[model samples]
Target: MVTPAYRMIRIKNASSIMKIIGFLYIFTIASLVGRTIAALEFNQMMGLFTPGLYQTLSFLALFLIMFVGNTGFVILLKEQVDQELLRVASFDDLTGILNRRTFVLLAKQIIAEHVKKQKHLSLVLFDIRYGGDEFAILLPEANEAESDRLVERFRLSAVQAGIPEIPATLSVSRGVVTIVPDQRTTLETLYNLCDRALYDAKGNGRNGAARTRIAL
Candidate 1:
């Protein structure tokens, strides 16, 4: 039973506690094998081997198994709950992308890193007004041409991969802004420019891309 339980834990890629318990099961098997070999070779039970001591060890082992099982279950459940909460807080329920608040928080750090590295950064915004689906992509060390190519690739892929529920192919309009970020550059400024470019795409007619370049 312990062997199978350990195998199941390994197959499931269970928590650290479960893995530790599995290792303990292995230790138990080794000890049991060593004891059996000693008993068979000696042709008599060791003087120290008493039925009462054996019973005590068995009870202690059972108590340990119960304690570890219950405690590990609670720890695993708590970890699962924490991961769920983090997912719900950090991602959009509908789109499964980073929510606006989480993006803003992480974008600040990304902007700082890019600025320090003196690298080009591109921000792309895709807004489906009718469906209320929005996506933002940040490309570090990407120039205007690279960003444009990526935007076009995404648009073409969306057009080619038709949604199962929709009768027609998906139309994606994107706004791209590429810049060599500096200390003065802010995420809000980049976002506003990208949003303006998105409107430009919409004005030119949907299913298109508009790109802007900032010197700073």
Candidate 2:
């Protein structure tokens, strides 16, 4: 969803300007032709050529062209802006991971499917408290940039963890990493166990990984 201000700004792009200019140019030509024809007939009826008739007609045509072109340009540009905003708003800029909102949506669908088929899935939630908020406060100018680097480091840590290299589905927030393990263990069992493992990792001093066992 694009904010109104963003949409307004996108409407000011060069493409929109060019489009408006093109439409107005065509409108100007058509209006001039129509005005010239009407002026000729009106002058004939009055038996005299009006001094400023052509000038007045030209001004009116210009105004109409501007009005219609500007309206159309805003409509088109707003739509484009809205589409781009949707893409940006759904993505997490830090780790290039799916944002929390999108992840939850996906989780719902996965849960429903697993319920129907009696399959298992695992979720691991862990927080990395090392270099947390203090690091951010220290580098205020480059906060997001540093956060991105930190996220990459975390991803590397995840890869190094003893878990088999299944297609790693990972989501990271400020200091939290939630890993969705491969569809091997039941969701209820996996969550409970992995949650404990996560606490164990935290207890072992912070930036580490632990896995929970499913006893089925």
lDDT per residue as tens, model 2, 27-131:
566656766677687653322344365556567667765686577668768867986797788877876666777765666666566556554433435453334
Off by over 4 Å in 2: 1-79, 129-193, 205-207
lDDT of 1 at 203: 84
- Estimated TM-score for each candidate: 0.72, 0.35
Put down candidate 1 lDDT per residue, 22-57, tens digits, no spaces. 666665555555556666785546444445443345
Cα deviation of 35 in candidate 2 (Å)? 38
Give the Cα-based TM-score of candidate 1 against the true structure. 0.72
lDDT of each: 0.77, 0.51
Highest lDDT: which candidate?
1
- For each predicted model, how many residue pairs clash, with residues at least 3 apart or on different chains? 0, 3
CA RMSD, predictions in order: 4.3, 13.6
Lowest summed lDDT window (length 10), candidate 2:
133-142
Candidate with top TM-score is 1
